[model samples]
Target: MTSSGTHTVDAVVVGAGHNGLVAANLLADAGWEVVVLEATGAPGGAVRSAEVTAPGYLSDLYSSFYPLGYASPVLRGLDLARYGLSWRHAPDVLAHLMPDGQAAVINRDPEVTAASLEAFAPGDGDRWLHAYADWQQVAEPMMTAITTPFPPVRGGLSLLRRLRTAGALRLARRLVVPVRKLGDELFDGAGGPTLLAGCALHTDLAPEEAGSGVYGWLLAMLGQQIGWPVPVGGAQQITDALVARLTARGGRISYHARVDRVLTARGRAMGARTVDGSLWRARRAVLADVPAPALYLDLVGAAVLPPRLVEDLAHFRWDGSTLKVDWALSAPVPWTNRAVATAGTVHLGADLDGLTGYAAALARSELPRDPFLLVGQMTTADPEHSPPGTESLWAYTHLPFRRDWRADEIAEHVTRMEQVLEDAAPGFRQLVVGRHVAGPADLERENPSLVGGALGGGTAAAYQQLFLRPIPGLGRADTPVDRLYLASASAHPGGGVHGAPGANAARAALARDRALTGAAYARLISTANRALYP
Candidate 1:
């Protein structure tokens, strides 16, 4: 272990999830001595996998599907296979079970997928090919920007270069349009809208939001290109690989260390004061991989925060809360529409109108009469995830962020969800041998950072993105304090297990060190203040 007093290194990273671990590994690789602090005994806040319900069954603590994982440049660059991480994709990407006896199955093979789509609506399948080609052109560079870090100048420029080579004018127009508009423009049919809406729902944004259309298009296309996969074991493999890489690069991890407050000396953030009364001072910088409110209100403290920052924090908006359900099934789900049985992911909604109504109800803080569901058949996706002959499944739905969900309401909702599956897959209820439910309150209990049980760290709406994320003025990882940076999903290029925020924070801290030597740390405080206020 590196001696703390004699050789204080470059950065101190809080949290050991994929993002924090990735940042720590990157800094260590760059020859900086990195130290990671985690609040929980285990790493990977949302990416954890454990045998919670049954002794042998490994359940994903939060996120399970990983189409994005394969597409991530940082993960690919790290080559996580060096650290015992491997991934497997489902034979088919998804199965959308309609209220009617019809279903759609999507696969990686364009021919097969197009065939499936063609079966639904003739030329719509060919339309998919055209859309996919356009998607491929934008995906690589767009992903690079979203996952690169705050401001994403390099990634943005790279995307611009690609667009210019392909069709700059067309791409530019697509960038500003809402996803719903894009879908309508391309495919003027129910199938296209239904498919695109499912993709857009993955983020916390509505399809009508400007920047959200890109996410919807990118995710759906990525699923087509690389089937939505899970790590052979679980989501933990991704986090473990990151931790292994960081440790291999000489980074240290301290668990059960909750940061009480960020400490500053002469207006420069020096380190953090842990809840246990121990202070761990950073020689270079402090990276906060927790949420924005936690970074600003809990750690940074109002005494240090400028007035504008306090006001900005007051107006931040969180997305709808979510309800997650995990089921242990004795028999395979019997979909009335047999095609749904073959799907790894199943989206449930009556129709486009039903989905829109669901979203509207959520916005108004009312439980929907007809809910839209995102379901994952875990055992189907990766057989090893559960005990033999038994299926494991995970499903979730968005609810009004703060609407009260009584025990009875939760039970009713779960029953309805099962009925939804039963409508498509009769006898779905009978297949369930065991069940565990995680409501919005439960999510908040698990990770306070997911305040109000909002995933994607507050809404991804146009009003809350990019320069306006978390707060209006300061969205670039740097906070209103010196050497302190927000490295969570709450920062720019928001959420979804991407390490952009942490990477951006580390880069800014490194940049500060380069600009003014030891004095650079002090400049961070002033600059952060200006950014937060301006």
Candidate 2:
């Protein structure tokens, strides 16, 4: 229901992104009166899909694949398939193409993947299988630890119980190991090492950075298990399913309602005011599905935040800016190596040394001359993405955030990116019936939470991860202010389409409002906040 001046609800959620919708659904499921406010006319933040390139060719505006979405326990528990969500996958999950034309392909069947790896090195197939077997032992508990709230009591205990069996300590060390080192330790050939290094580049992490292996190993393992699926029609279907589920549960989302400020009283978040001058008063809580800086600095106002938090925000780092190009192709990408055509997602880079150089350039605040590309074969993954006999494709690469992405700059980057694609796929440019480019500025204009096009909310570097995320405290959703939760990718378990941050926020709010423990919970959280932020 639309309201004029003052609207009251049990909870007010800022942003209608996937995380916000997830938070709203969970709150509504508990019978709380919840309302979500979104700045854009559409609901999805980065998950939207449209025919940006050409008619009848749907392209995901931002994220495309679904390995994390498929493996996420929070998203899985929602049973979104009941609300019109269906997944489709290509025959092969991913193929990483090197400049030398050698490719490492991951197949759904482990034996097939192993065989492909074996072709690169004699004993690597068995080595891959051994690693997979080890992952199998701790997969459940480890995923739980990752997707659940911080401290992860249950998941942590479960890991402890399986310590000896799962090689828990060794696995923990591997989680922090650099992808470059991890690849060398695990495989003797370029194929295996290239595959791991390429997957690690999916994030802002460089191959040599600590904790890069965690992302690389996790994503590679997920591709093996789930095949990096996509929604049947487009990425929008995932958003539609979440919205369907949310509205069905009696939650309402107000579109074009941009929250300008969080209304507070006595240091507690009580509501939020939109740019339209409408006040949404929440009697229970307010959850913000925005980047940390946006919530703490712009919306809440720096004066209202603790001086320490305001100072800490100065040190907050964003992931690299992005440059994306979408193409509506009249025919499939004619990859030089036929094997590359089989996969839904492809990683284009030279090798480990090239990846390191690319990272070095970004660190120096210069765009890489040869950028590493993460490409998606939309039509290959799901035929509905485009007209029959044609393909909907997109590729994105990271750039240093310091660069100015003007129109001319965007054009130059697009040409460079296409050149990289053309090298892997001969005549790649000839098949383009239509083309669209989105640089960092365009992305930020579309979704403010994607500051500088940093998709992961913030850097996933070890210094800013886990308990230290978005500035240290208890890594839970509770913020310095009472009755407010950070329900975005900026929170714990940093980025991905998993919706764990939102789930964690909702769960914290629910626990704080519980009948018997309500007061105690609030007091405990407040006490922790004081100590951390003081």
Candidate 1, lDDT over the whole model? 0.77
Candidate 1: which stretches are off by over 4 Å? 1-10, 403-405, 515-534
TM-score, model 1 to reference: 0.93
Evaluated against the true structure, the overall lDDT of model 2 is 0.90
Candidate with best lDDT: 2
- Quantify all predictions' global Cα lDDT against the true fold: 0.77, 0.90
**For residues 464-493, could you state the per-residue lDDT of candidate 2 as single tens digits?**
888888887788899988899999999998
Candidate 1: Cα lDDT at 99:
66
Q: Kindly give the stretch of ten consecutive residues in candidate 2 with the minimal lDDT sum.
A: 401-410
Cα lDDT tens digits for candidate 1, 1-534: 212222245687887767788778778878888888787788887888877666566678788888777888877877889999888877788876666656666788987777776776768788888999988877777788777655677877877787774586777677667777877877745566567767788776666667657776777788898888888888888888888888888889888777788888766788877677767778878898888888888888887777888887888887788888888888777766767776778888755566667777777778887778898888888888788887788788887877356878878888777777667666788887778888877877776666667878878887888878878854677676777777888888787866677677777777767754647655655666675586
